[model samples]
Target: MITRILLAVDDSPAAMASARHAIELAACLGARLHVVTVVPDHSLSNLVTRMGSHPGVHERRDQAAEAILDHVVRLARASEVEADAHLLEGDAARRILAEARSMHADLIVVGRSEGLDRSTTAHILEFAGQPVLVVPPEVR
Candidate 1:
């Protein structure tokens, strides 16, 4: 009965893999896809320019999120699924969880990168306590 599925994606290879998997699943289940991307509230450019590294951190993060969101929307359209996209700023896992709840998603899909960040991603899956699909980076 997973009519609504949320995909928590970044621009990583693993995330892209998960997005593709989510597309296939959505098509199979006749589900709607809710694609969301989160950017950390910090910008390298602002950090270097302002020296304060405070202003526009959120802004830059939001911009990155928007780009990822747009990518997801395009993916959905190509896949021929009813889909929508969201851009948010904050911790990736937190924003993803929030978006899933707000969208009333029946399931969530995330990607696991092949680096030190993998443990952090694992922690997200453990902490979220919701059904999550973890796509490996090599799956693509």
Candidate 2:
């Protein structure tokens, strides 16, 4: 009954692992995949610009987010699963949850990076009504 899957990814090794898992799960379940990447809020970017500290920071982040989405989407399509990409701006956890609800996803998938704080994943688990699958970093 899990026909729609929402995958939140970043440019991290763990996220790549999660992308692979998501692709496999989608293919097995015949589910449509929705891939999403979030950038920092526009207001924060503006503040940084105003401070004259990091010009083009937002642009770089956007480009990186696009690349991440493109890579994941391509992988999903190669597995013959229908996939859509979303580039969102704002809080990562909130945006992901909203997208899940917007797409009516049956499940959510995310990656837990090694040594990184788990606040984002924790928030998602605390609020997401649907089941969530957390993929750990691939051990080499």
The Cα local distance difference test for each model comes to 0.80, 0.92
Model 2, poorest ten-residue lDDT window? Answer: 112-121
The reply for model 1, stretches above 4 Å from the true place, is 43-45, 52-64
Write down the RMSD of all candidates, one decimal each: 3.0, 1.6
**Highest lDDT model number:** 2
Clashing pairs in 1: none
lDDT of 1 at 66: 86
- Model 1 Cα displacement at 63 (Å)? 4.3
lDDT of 1 by residue, 1-140 (tens): 89999988888988888998999999889899998876655555556558874666655667777888888878888889899987776677777777777777789998887777676577678766468888888632
Q: Give lDDT tens digits, candidate 2, residues 1-140.
A: 99999999998888899999999999999999999998878887788889987899789879888999999999999999999999998888999999999889999999996554389999999999899999999999
Model 2 bad stretches (over 4 Å): 114-117
Give the C-alpha miss distance for residue 101 in model 2, angstroms.
Answer: 1.0
